[model samples]
Target: MTEFAPDAGFRKNRKLKDALLQHKALSKDGLSERLFSLLFSGLVYPQIWEDPDVDMEAMELQPHHRIVTIGSGGCNMLAYLSRHPSSIDVVDLNPHHVALNRLKLAAFRLLPVHADLVRFFATPKLSSNSAAFDRFIAPELDVSTAAYWNGRDLYGRRRITVFNRNIYETGLLGRFIGAAHLLARLHGVRLQRITEARTLREQRRFFEEEIAPIFDRPVVRWLLSRKSSLFGLGIPPQQYDELASLAGGGSITQVLKQRLEKLACHFPLQDNYFAWQAFARRYPDAGEGPLPTYLRPEHYPAIRANAGRVTVHHASFTELLAAEPAASRDRYVLLDAQDWMTDEQLNALWGEISRTARPGARVIFRTAAEKSIIEGRLSPALRAQWHYDEERSQALNVRDRSAIYGGFHIYGKAA
Candidate 1:
């Protein structure tokens, strides 16, 4: 992990430097890592990956296609498994996410029955549900992942036990939210009420009555103007700048709150798994069970059979593609990773992607900027080989989350 001093030229932009300097100096509060660890540590948690629904549609995944995806928190990867693709390779820059994926895979492999697995993930207060870890899941985990849970936290709490106790709040993003909740409290705003609305109407009512008021506050507006404040949400300097640029100036908070309101007010609490994670920090109790397929009871056999096809690595996307045989994969999911890359990185990644494209292969990615990153960067010779489907890509995006991203693109090798 690279440790960036708050005073350092964090990125190429002067605005970002000013933004970081404006925020409070980095503190150890609840973070697992001290200063250096954050700079050098694996990404703190899984990113908000592109909508799984969007990814499935854009890929037009068939039983024959091999899929490669950045395994953020592993939710979409598990979601993809439900479709039963021929093979799925989930890679991540964070060892923690990789470990999380491995644990999910092991759960699918060893859970004795679907209902048992469902109870394990969907049950309220998982650790208190004693039958879960010892009876059904623990024996399945590999040693490395098992060790992860056994580790100690800053509080010296057994981290493995936190899974049973706090699986819902274990990621970098989760920790960020915890801190945000504290920060919001310090600001004299409350987020707890936002989660209590029982219906979409109720949700919207609450947003208007209880949440929207914060958007107009001077403090909220000030925080929105600074890029460093968003670092707590795991957004890097460049992503913060791009997101700020999207809404122009300090209005970004209003833009985000509006979208979050959509997430809260439009989707049913029962159907919106992302919202469930955000608000309640747990899955709904429907018999259909927790959202991800790897968390599902019935999918284990197939997931285990397919798990071997995955090889988790702590490498850049470009580096992984370089090591692969040409034409080795049929689908690529870049998620929002391009937003974090430089022009040279994007070109090199695209270069290898072009070389590795099988006939009709498709590459998918989301951008923080509204336009596709490849607009004029790729050589015409390379660009000509792949077809960009703008309309279809636009249609795949879910409204609430799509509002946060500039573009969702799919490039296919033309037949």
Candidate 2:
């Protein structure tokens, strides 16, 4: 797999009409299993979580804890595995994501060696080594997952084609980015050109000169103001309100600029490889370490050791919590999953969490609002046993990364 760069030339207009139709029709729910099953569906890429280091910092996890988290894209599951916890239960509602996680775990277990796995996932272009997949990864996948990868997309292209090719523009967030890119192109701005800058100084220049100018455009501003518009990026409605409030007018462009500004300016461009991926579409190099260390060769021993401690489930958090033994889990990572729920749903989820959480257990989650989602909502009995670290959580909030989010919270079960 060649490291996909920002300047990777896109095949212009291969299926322009279809892309437009899907883009227009991708409502709030967007891209169901039926759609994914029919689309260029291969085992999607393994990497999914954002800022593992930041997440760990926020979590303050201990070695002895058993954790539960919403699996989402599975990046965090692998990352937490690196911490060597007693156990982790990852549950998700998305079947595609569940399959992706299972495939990743299988790859970790069956790959010939770590470097082989690293090269398989981190190489610049995947087509360069069909042998890697055919020989190791493909064989390891379960039958259903294998079938998924064999499926075709809107363009009638097989999902496996993404490996030999770059499909950075495919996920929910990716599609939103594609839409934003097209809109930028229409307004005579080229995001790809700016995103390709090699240096921090160059990145700043691009953001200020090319990217910044687009925010002032009337069409961009109007579209950005709508709460439902960012569903493509997976931002829930309540979160959109919080993010909009952060921008002073809820301008998506403004919020994006502010967040990208941090990625571009706060950390060294070399160290902040995540910035490179967001802007440049690739890692700096292997010497910088595999894109995700838990997926890398060096940590495979730890991952393998901890892998057995995990159980992956496709279910709602509320449902999962209800079935778990009382006072069993020590750590819970909700990961902004609450934003998708209604008030009644939130109450139900927390009620079970309160019952299942052991004394001294810690729960961390992000929300679409700046305040604790449970503060006024949880039943008095449930809320009373959980101690909210308000001041610390506020201090830990990274405005730039969370500019699109409402808040990050940490709570401890009162002993």
Candidate 3:
């Protein structure tokens, strides 16, 4: 099977470089940034980590609304279609993600049935997936997108072969979870044990007895201290600092443990697919546990019917928004992209968002730390155009099934 060369044209991507490169080339921080950029240059998120249910609730998505969002892993974009939004413009700096988003859209449109789409995306080790992609998905793809899947890696196999294996286990986030599982196993802790708990009580017991102890290990603490160790989580150095700050002068491992505990205990395993991916590696077998909204059999019809409403772009969110007319878009989903931006970038992003926002337009994003990162960052005038719903944002943050992010924020364009 072909492995993706994640950094095929990484150096030439100025936007990515601008977002990631912050320190001198020979500096310690600089190397970590470069390394993360390289890994991120390929497929980082096989599945987006943010919970779309929480996102939909926060944004109050409507059928007449036009949505613009950062297209990470593309699941949420499809998930949003359940609300029947008029259109979704998805932008990303990584071409691999753009290609993946397009591939998912094509799969939804052309696959013969819901089960066929499931087999192609969710089933692992299915040898016929590549054949299905070739026959159904490839012919309809635009030239560049077709070239992306047809393109070969260092090994002499097409990129589409990733479908035949576990697509969830192939990207940077997948590898990170895989490594975490391995590390847990090495310490005689099976993280998957948490998934076996049928009740929240059992979940907490499993976390306390089995998973929590691993954080106290000297090696585990040392590993957590290194910013490079988290690159697989798609966390750049800037975001890592925010996560560390959340530790509040305590061990970063404690923060990780708390987040993991929430993931294990806050939601029932049967209802949270994010927990399944974290512990079980693949999504639950059909009808056994929850899947992302886009992958649920019931949501399939709606997503397929509305798949054409999405347009995928290989550009930054701010750049894409900059091209739109004023007061044109009604919803924005930034994911956690802002956690990586500089103050100047944040101002530029809000400037465009404020300009393009329709009346009552809502914006939702996540943060690495438990507070809104935009406070005092956006220029005062730009900030005044929006109202931050502090109580609602905090309420929703606890409800985010992903449990990886510290804050889930909601802002509304001031009427």
Best of the candidates, TM-score: 3
C-alpha lDDT (0 to 100) for residue 106 of candidate 1: 64
lDDT, candidate 3, at 77? 97
Candidate 3 residues lying further than 4 Å off, grouped into runs, are: 6-11
Clashing pairs for model 1 are 1-39, 1-40, 1-41, 2-39, 2-40, 114-297, 127-164, 149-160, 327-356
lDDT of 1 by residue, 1-415 (tens): 2111111111233322222222245533223223323532433554344567678878888878888888767767877776778877777665566666776666666766666656655555566434456566567676666666555554566554554565556555666667666666676656666556667788788768766776778977887776556665566666666777768744578667856676667776655666666655666566422465455556566665665656666455677788889988899999877776666666788888888878889999887766787878777777888899988877765543324566788888987
Assess each prediction's global lDDT (C-alpha) against the native.
Answer: 0.64, 0.64, 0.88
**Local error of candidate 2 at residue 248 (angstroms):** 6.4
After TM-score superposition, the amount by which residue 338's alpha carbon in candidate 2 deviates from its true location, in angstroms, is 0.8
Report the lDDT of model 3 for residue 379.
Answer: 91
Q: Specify the highest-lDDT model's number.
A: 3
Best-to-worst TM-score order: 3, 1, 2
Cα deviation of 95, candidate 1, in Å? 1.2
Candidate 2 lDDT tens digits, 19-76: 2122224554344322432221222233453556656776676788888987766877
Candidate 1 stretches greater than 4 Å from native: 1-43, 46-49, 128-143, 183-198, 249-251, 287-290, 293-305, 399-403
